[model samples]
Target: MTATPVLVLLDHAADGTLRPPVRELLTLARELAGDAGVQGVWAGDEDVAAAVPALAAQGVTTVHRLATDTDVHLSAVLADGLEAALAASGAALVLLVSSFENKEAAARLAVRTGAGVVTDVDGLEVQAGRVVAHKTVLAGTWTTRCAVSAPTAVVTVKANSVVAQDAAAPSSPQVVDLPVEVRASSTRVRLVERTELAGSGRPDLGSAHVVVVGGRGTEGDFSAVEELADVLGGAVGATRVATDEGWIGHDAQIGQTGVTVSPRLYVGAGVSGAVHHRGGMQASGTIVAVNSDPDAPIFEIADFGVVGDLFAVLPQAAAELRRLQG
Candidate 1:
């Protein structure tokens, strides 16, 4: 009999390395599996199975490697490979990160396997006869606990919500052969030139221990906030408005439509703080807000508040932090 598997989605980067979202999902997989076994699935240029040993510290026992190559990058192929792996491994659950590229894989995999699919779950627990995960609804105002409708469940969890669990020892990932079917579909998005962004020497937003965010209230300049983030040795974040206005990159946006993060500390600058935006970053362990206006909504959630303009506060804070560090 095949061993039970809990598939964790793997992110293949331009450098042919796994991204943190995949590791985050692996950590969650270990949480759900507990003493149970886990098997990971990845469809990419190289075998993701090679990284399984790193995941084993979190209790992952096996890795399913898909050797198929695709002319078009579609989630269908991922799901196709997953079905084969699930059937072969007898997985009780499959874990995924809530990302655009992987959504189709989770959706199609569920349909093909007749499994219950859950999306954007903030937390997971075992209750009654099924597994339960919490989902925030109505822009984080209402929280709902959703139970999986099937014994075999498919889950898409938000990024930065879980800790990265490590595997045992230095054992490398054992490779398992996967079966996949390549069919001609209208969904043909080809892979073009892929490149990595220049390293800013900041931690990843989704995985950072600390995050510093700025918004429209920054008065169209974030040099102050950026310096403060550097001082804190953390990643910089921005609101949707900052990204929309091109004040910051889209990757830096923090909101419902942006990257979800749960850091030890999060500092907001000049942000009024909308519910949608808060829905993503509210899970942060601590919140601090600096704004010219005391009435900004961000101050309500902030553990520390400074009622001053970000432009004035950030530079002073940065300089002070540098002096303190010396």
Candidate 2:
């Protein structure tokens, strides 16, 4: 008997390609499925059949294409389409990337299917005929394990929490067109317009290999840090204090209350490494802290440390990096 497939909801980029986070989810689904099959869902108005090959390369056995013109509201339509897919496929487990839209959709799906919902799950597996999720709790202080007792399990994995690896042997996935009719919801929320933020030409903060973060010690001047990030082809990050002081955009803030990032290299300048700030970046592969005070809390976690003023050190470091690149 064929094992029940794990349904994965994949997000697409503007060019109709699957996003990196979606690829990560595919990886997680593949692992969780194990002996079971892995299935994918691409929900949008765009023709994303081109993504099937990539999904197949990631171990997806089947792909369900749903055309939903979610220009009005995406979550409602996606939830409705996913519900239909679950009913048709009889999939017991649904995996999604922990993006804003996907999380909302997962909640709606749980409500409709009466499935147990788990969010921000970084670890998932099948244990003793049940789906178990491992999630960080209390601001990354502890890890809690929870099992999905319902018939269907809806879980969202944090972006970049899992690495995407190629399947040992690639197979072409059978693509199925799922007919879905989306209607406007009674909810007053409507998408009037979408203003895309101007591109910064830097890597996404969450997925960047290197991140240069500024703190209160920078005295609000991020030019040096920005220069270093630009030289390293990385993203710019900021502490909560710096963002609260309006020295940087809130989107760039990294902390317990802000977004979490897991970069390969993290460079913190003038940061004292408060628990909130450390919570966001402690997972980085290598940490380099630069602070005037050698006793700064950031030094405790830093793989390398420099006791100096950022203004004096950052420019010198940027120049050296530029010269090395040149």
* Candidate 2 residue pairs in clash (backbone atoms < 3 Å): none
Assess every candidate by TM-score: 0.86, 0.86
Write one digit per residue (lDDT tens) for candidate 1, span 249-324: 8999888778887778999998888887898788777899988888888788888999987888889888998999
Any idea what lDDT model 1 has? 0.75
Any runs in candidate 1 off by more than 4 Å, and if so which? 1-3, 47-53, 167-172, 186-199, 323-326
Off by over 4 Å in 2: 181-188, 244-246, 315-326
Q: Per model, how many backbone clashes are there?
A: 6, 0
Highest lDDT: give the candidate number: 2
**Candidate 1: deviation at residue 264, Å?**
3.0
> Per-residue alpha-carbon lDDT of model 2 for 105-163, expressed as tens digits?
89998987899999988789888878999987665557899998888899988766778
lDDT of 1 at 273: 83
